[model samples]
Target: MNSDIRQLEPKQLWNKFADLNAVPRPSKKEERVIAFMKDFGESLNLETMVDEVGNVIIKKPATPGMEDRKTVVMQSHLDMVHQKNADTDFDFDTQGIEMYVDGDWVKAKGTTLGADNGLGVATIMAILESNDIEHPAIEALFTIDEETGMTGAQGLKGGLLEGEILLNLDTEEDDEIGVGCAGGIDVTATRTYNEEDATEIKIGYTIAVKGLQGGHSGMQIHEGLGNANKIMNRLLFDGFENFGLRISEIDGGSLRNAIPRESFATIAVDAVHKEAFELEIKLLADSIKKEYKTMEPDMEVIVTSVDAPAKVMDLGVQEGLTRAIYAACNGVYRMSADIPDLVETSNNIARVIVKDGNIKIGCLTRSSVESSKMDLANMLRATFELTGCEVEFSGSYPGWTPNMDSAILKVMRALYVDLNNEEPHVAACHAGLECGILGTNYPEMDMISFGPNIKGAHSPDERAQISSAQKYWKFVLEILKQIPTK
Candidate 1:
């Protein structure tokens, strides 16, 4: 953590944020961070409890004369998406995040800043530790494993929280209040293939697609950015048909929630067609560069000569894999009928790998409507099944339906207008939020999500605006003061 961050406005919040940066809190590996939260809550003398699923909840009594106000549940995830640059030497499971101030933003060096939910958690910490701030009874909920899966939210039991109103501090834009979010599911397909001995008459080469500006699969899916896996598949399909290319290995993207930035494959080419293959690859690279010149200016494709492999995948399997990837859904499929510019359905062709005598593909699909989500899932199932691959879905979660008559929405909107003299934008997000899953457990809770301006979440370029953090803190304090009496 940088010393300058400690000097930022709203000293309490910034101080807690700086402390959070000193702990490693990647998804599904949040033992240390959870322990930190437990200690912090105990030190403050608050009523704290850890649920069976590892969710930390701290109850703070209302200030004197404000005991009649409704209990407010402030929620944020404890874990963060761990993404680092290909060249960075860092271990998210053991090393703390290195944070610094850049111009008007706070960012981590060559890694995700964890501002998506860390800032939210810090804000809750500041509220819990403050002695001068007046507010209603508060229940601060810090969930775990939100980035990879909503495990904490899914396992939380009803009656665990006594709050009637919930404020989810996980939205990205400072000026927008998120009332609803899309649901999502993971789809995986696999197929087995026989390996054959590489013939002596063939030469080996490694083809790679890299330098794409990959980002959050759901939030940045409509940006028109290139998918490295899709691009490599196109190149391989052409080579298989034109140059009799036989593939021995395939690997790409790591996470299912992030758009693929790079992909690599090793292939064998007939000695007689090696020269033609090289020329064809150069032409293809030039054409692709032109296609994504604006959206992915750094996109690159390279083919390098390598020693021949001992074994290669069957010719039929190679062709089938390429064809299946080419046909899979990879982007926004529909727009919301009620909300203009909102994405209603989308799919991310997240990952691909060939190992253990099988080729596996991973995908993530999201939609605000359940029917539309199932529709897209069936479409992807049909495409992969046609290629003789088995398809399965997992980790499915529901969407939060927007309530036009929400009490918190009415309170926050009026509060924003009074504070800034301008109406704040109230909208639904295309990305997944834990609110949807939590809503199922606490059906009567009135919920809304809002946070300081954060950009490039789930990617190495993630950052948060410093000024927005201070302003958000002030806004939250004011909302607490204005909560209605029960």
Candidate 2:
């Protein structure tokens, strides 16, 4: 735990957050964090249980005179998106996150801060451990695999939780309440390729696209930020058509939820056209720079000499893969007709890799409307299938429709108005939240999601504002105190 963080306001919350940072809790791999939560619950003499899918449920009895209020389920995921800068050397499976106080915010060095849901998890831990704070019956629900897949929320059974009101703490903005969220599906396309000896190539070079500000695919997709995979493919397709380039390997992106920041490809160019190819690449880079000058001023395109590979992808496969990727849909597809500024449907071309004998492409499609989500997924499937690649879709989750008359929403809004002297912004998010799945399991539960200010989630530049953390903690405590009697 960092000493500086322990000195922050809401001391208990910051202390618990520091403790969480001392343990590795990457998405889909949260055994240590789960154990930590269990031990913490036991230490408080509270009832604790782990569900079949690893979701942790800790129950705490209400304080004297508060038992009459409805049970409030404070929810957050245990796992976080693990992302690091290309130059950083850290292991997500074993190493604890190294974080430091950066002026008014807390940030990790060359790596993600994990504050997206960690702060929420730590807040619940602090509440469970504190005896001075007043609150009604509490259920701290810590879900797993929220970043890569919402397995914990998906597998959670109905009737297991008795809470009538759910307070989801995974939202990023401090001033907004997330009343609903978009559902999502994962799509993958794969095609086996034949390799042939590299005979026509005289010079080999590695082309790289880097230094772009990759963020959460859903939250930041509408920002018009550069997609590394798309940018690299543009160069590859142009080179293949005009420079007679032969690709040996292609790799880009790391996670499906994150916009790709870097892409690399190894290719060969005939010695006769080397100068022309270099000139063409330079021109292409210049053009791309101009296109994204304001959004991605730091974006870089570099080419350097490399050893020639013994094998290269077949000409047909190379052209087909390049063309399909270039033609694939990415970013926002539709905007909400009801809610201003809300995304109704979107797609993220998240990852691409070429290895062994095949090339694979991965995409995530999201929408508030189920039919629209499927329509976009089918569109992506058709685009890849037309290129002779096999496509599969999985991990589909339902969207949460907003309830304007939600009881908890009214309580939280009144509480926030009293605390901040102003009404909070209420809206639905484009990003996938566990609230959608949890709502399905407990249809009667009144749900609302809000949290401290967290920026750059799913990226190395992630940070959490300290002042907002303090304010959020106070706001939540006030909300707990005002929960209506059941």
Candidate 3:
């Protein structure tokens, strides 16, 4: 139970995490969490204010003898990516996350653990509400909508902060210090298709692709894990090519940042081809399962018979749509030549929906290079446009350029070495972070990111390492004390 979660060592941190999880704070719908943070700052009698974009800022004076240190902006996002299992009955907008302790990790019941940025937020909150911890003049920045569009970071006006340095406590790996991150853009394709009447000779069937381990699109895109949308499209493409399958509706994936884990579709086929359709689909399912048996051992492709739909998509449009999806890029597009083993450009076919006479496909394309990013985006656009989709690009953001010569980077590297007796891996990650956007407004603030171990982010399997949190807490305290003097 969360009661046990609040009792975790360093009660200051876990207790705050428990408090924050009690409020529903889905991305783009952060009113309650924003208010909760505002009330929290006010309760402590700190200087609190809400920005025009719904970000909450709380300022706390320095501790005794620490007034000479440069001010620090401790930052984390307020909203979380809301994802749940297909069988988990939960409402992200109305209910708090149901959390529990499992060995050395805390997780939610068949839902996302929200540890991506929630842990960072809780860390800042703990320090803000504490009187015993030593620190410089603290500015706690809680930005909203970070999981979706990062509008809070983008809309933040300049000259609002007095901090000379920034500590972004949002990175996942404990053994790495983040110096840069990839930028991203949202690509959406939509078009209307003519509906054809389902003849009496047609029979209906449902196809479901589930049990895949979906994760963060940018961070885990290179893992070769199963993508439900791609997998579902493969089956549909094959079924139509062989047995003349007609799709009535297709629904796959949830958010553009998360790899698709589950997809379901309603399709129709001629009565004469029913047996062939089932046999071919199941055979292909077995083959596909064998292909991913190592990475996705629990992957299942379920087929069931149902009542035929009243209408189905035109054959020409269906053919084009399926082919375009099959041809589009879904995983790591390019690996960096400068950074070994790092994905430089990638795309996530995050969402696919087909209903009535409308079809929409959503993708999130990310890259460290602006030219490479647009190159892949245009490639996807041309592919979809050939199939008659009107594509629009939005939410474009720049990547954080690496600064190995940074003053804070030097301090944190030395600090990590002293604490763990080992050098931390200093590298740029593929995930999207708000630091790059915030830097545009505060150009001189030296930024760095580090955090505890979080695995399977942007998925239901998300969990935080307990021992790593304790180690990070120790590191946070030392970093605060070592903040460079003015």
Candidate 4:
């Protein structure tokens, strides 16, 4: 464990965070973190339960005078999405996260900070250790595989928690309370064709889109971060109509939930037009950069050469793949008409790859309304089918539907007004949260999510505002203390 981070506020919480940061607890590889949590709970003399998939449930009795208050489940996920900058040398499964304090924020060096849900975990730990705060029975639920799939929540059996009220610690913003979130479905499309020889007598160049500020697809999708794959596809389709360019290899995007920051395509073109091709690529990049100046100022596009000449995709396959990706949904399609400034329906063209004898494309669709989500997914499936590609959809998790008149929402709003002299902003998030799935598992439960201000989650630019942590901590403590006993 790094000794320096132990100096941060809430010493024990930061100490454990730094220790877990050194354990390489990326999604699906959380055994060490799980063990650490289990050991911590055992040391606290709390009843602990861990499922086969690494989801840990630690039950703690209330503070001395609040034993009769209603039990509240403080929940957060255990796993985190591992993302690093293109230049970072760290390995997700082996190396520890290198974190540092930047002014009033905490961030990782050239990688994601893992604060999306880590703050929630650490706060629960701090609450568990605190004898001063008063609250009812607390079931600290730590779920697994939240970044990729809601596998832990989906596979959850009933009767895990005794609490009917759940507080989700996954929201990114500090001042806003997340009452609802979009449900999401993963749609994959694939096409296979026989390889063909490079018949076009053409020069080869790699067209690349880079430097865009890619962020969490759900959280920052509205921020207008450029999608490299989509931009590259647009450039190729629009520019190459007058030239003969066939893509030999195409690659872009990393995580299913992050806006792609960079993408590259190797193309075969006529030797005579090499100079013109480079000029066009430059122009295209400049055009996109100008278009998204406010959101992605660093966006860049480039052309280069590689040695692999024999392996090339068929022109038919290339055209079909390009059309499928370009035609599919790329950004927020519809804003919520019901809620002002809320994104009601959106789609992320997640990833594209040529693997295992097939060219596959993954798209994630999200919406707060269940039927709206289905409509978007169906639209993408229809679009892919038009390209003669086979498509499949995963079983989607439900959205956490909002109840503006919720009892807990009322209490939280009142508490914020009492503490901050102003009402907290109540809104729904575009990102997927486990509250939806968990709510389904326990239908009668009331759920809401809130967290410290974490910017650029699931991306290399991730940072947490240190000032927000103290406010959130104080607010949480006050809420627990104000709970009424039966």
Work out the TM-score per prediction: 0.97, 0.98, 0.99, 0.96
Better of 2 and 3 by TM-score: 3
**Residues 194-235, model 2: lDDT tens digits:** 998888546899999999889999888899999999999999
Better of 1 and 2 by TM-score: 2
Please report, in order, the local distance difference test score of every candidate based on alpha carbons: 0.91, 0.92, 0.95, 0.82
lDDT string for model 3 (387-463, tens) is 99999999999999999899999999999999999999999999999989999999899999999999999999999
- Residue-pair clash count for candidate 1: 0
Candidate structures ordered by TM-score, highest first: 3, 2, 1, 4
- The numbered model that scores best in lDDT is 3
Please state the error at residue 481 of candidate 1 in Å.
1.3
Clashes of 2: 0
Q: State how far residue 141 of model 2 sits from its true place (Å).
A: 0.4
Q: Tell me the deviation in Å of residue 339 in model 1.
A: 1.2
- Give every collision pair in model 1: none
Alpha carbon lDDT at 74, candidate 1: 97
Estimate the lDDT of model 1.
Answer: 0.91
Report how far off residue 107 is in candidate 4 (Å): 0.7
